[model samples]
Target: MKIKKVKPYNQEEDKTKQLSRMFNTISSKYDQFNDIMSMGLARVWRKKAILSLKPYKHDTILDIAAGTADIGIKAFEYITPTQITGIDVSEKMLEIGKEKVAEAGLNDKISLKVEDVSKMNFADESFDAAITSFGIRNFDKLEESIREVHRVLKPKGKFVILEMSEPRMPIVKQGYLLYTHTLIPFAVKTFSNDPKAYKYLTKSMEAFPQGKEFIAILNQNGFNCLKYKTFFMGVCSLYVIEKYSS
Candidate 1:
C-alpha cells in the first residue's frame, strides 16, 4: 500500500474529535476487518493480556476504547469482575458492541458507554483496573491519555494496554513489514470499501512507539510495576503496569 498523506488532526489539538471522526467512520466493518487482518489471533492475544491482569472476583474493571466490547467480554470470561464498563468515543462502535453484548446476555455485567479517553467522565480513583486494546495509537494526546489512565485508577489500580508493534529482529521485522505494509492491506482492501481506513491502520501502527519506549512512557506517567511480555516474536506486547498511590 502506497502511503498517502491523509491529513490527520494533530493529537495536540483535539484527540477525541479526531478519533471520533475516524472510529465512527470505520465502525460498521471494523470488527470483521479486524478478524481477517489479524488472522484471528487478536482474540487470543487479548485473552492473554486480560489474564495477565490477575483480576479478582471482587474487582471492578474498565475497558477503555473497548471497541465492540471484545476485550471486556474476554476479561469477564477470565476473572469474572464485579462490574465491567467499556467506554469508547464512537457511538456507532458502541452500538455495535452493545448488540454483541446483549446477544451474550451480558448487558447486566458489561456496560458500554461512548467516552473519550483523554477525558473520561469518571470520578478520580473510579476503577480497580483499566484496559484498552489496539486503541492507544489513535490517541491524539497519547501522553495525556496515559495520565488520564492514572487519574481514573484507584491508587494501586492495574492498567493493561494491548497494542500493535513492529517486529524487532532484523529478519522477522523485514518479513512482518512486507506482510503488513503490503499483503494484509491488499487483502483488507478487497473486502473493505474504505481503503483509506486500512491505509490509516498501516500508517498508525508504523508510526506508534512500542516495547521499552512505551514502557518508559508508562513509568513516567505515574505508573508503578511497569513491565511487558511480548507475543509472536515481539509483534505485539501486553503491558502490565500498576498505579501505586498515583
Candidate 2:
C-alpha cells in the first residue's frame, strides 16, 4: 500500500518547508510539548536509542533532525563520543539547542547547524555513527534522506533511529489512538503556539510505514538492519542499522 504524504499545513509548500516553519513556530515549547505528549518517557527512549550505539565506534556522531539537541545532549550521558554534529532545518530550534548545549557545558562537544538531511554538505564517510530521534517521519524524501545518511557514514557505521509508531495490539491501539488524537490535540490547543503542528505530527505518525515496512526502506538504501525493537507496546520503535562494509 502507498503511504499517504502528510504536510503540516494545507498550502502549496513542500513538506520540508512546511515542517521547518512549523517547528520554528513551536521551537520554544517543543520540549515541554514532548513532555506532555510522552508523559516524560521521551527522555528514557532517547537514552535507549543513544545507548544502542554504545558498542559501535561513535567518536564522531551525526545527529539528524537534532531539534533542540535532545539526542545530542543525551549522548554524553550514555557514551563518550568526542564530538556530535547536529543538523536541522529550523534555525530557531537550533538556536535554542545551541543555548542548551552551552549551558550543559557541551559547547565544545556539540555543534548545531541549519541543514537538511537530504542535502548535507559533508564529505562522504564523515561520521562514525549517526542518530535521529522522533524525526524520521518528517523527512520529505525519506529514501533520499536515508541514502544521504548512508553516504555520510563510514563503512560499517551504525545509524540509530527512534520514532513514534501506531500500536498494533488491539487494546493498546485503542488507548494509543485516544491519547494521540484526543488528548494530545487538546493539550496542544491549550498550550502550544501552533496547535495545528501536533495535529500534523499525529497524522504523520499514522501515515508513516512501520515495522518490516520501514526496515525494507533501510535495506534498500544501503543499510542492513541489525535490530528492531518496540517500546511501550509499540507506541515507539527503535531501529539500529549498519552501513554495508563493501
- lDDT, candidate 2, equals 0.93
What is the overall TM-score of model 1 with all chains considered together? 0.91
lDDT of 2 by residue, 1-246 (tens): 466889998757898999999999999999998988999999999999999999999999999999999888889988999999999999999999999998899999999999999999999999999999989999998999999999999989999999999999999999999988789888877898888898998999999999999998888889999999999999999999999854
For candidate 1, write residues 1-246 as lDDT tens digits: 122223244435454676677778888989888888888889889988888887422288889889889987777788768889999988989998999988888889899998788888999989989888998887767778889989988877888888988888999999999989889877876787667667778878877877767777778888865568778987787888888662
Off by over 4 Å in 2: none
Span of 10 residues, lowest total lDDT, candidate 2: 1-10
**lDDT scores in order:** 0.81, 0.93
Among residues 3 or more apart in sequence or in different chains, the pairs in candidate 1 whose N, CA or C atoms overlap within 3 Å are 11-140
What is the lDDT, from 0 to 100, of the residue 227 in candidate 1?
A: 64
TM-scores of the models, in the order given: 0.91, 0.98
Best by lDDT: 2
After superposition, the stretches of candidate 1 with alpha carbons farther than 4 Å from their true spots are: 1-15, 55-58
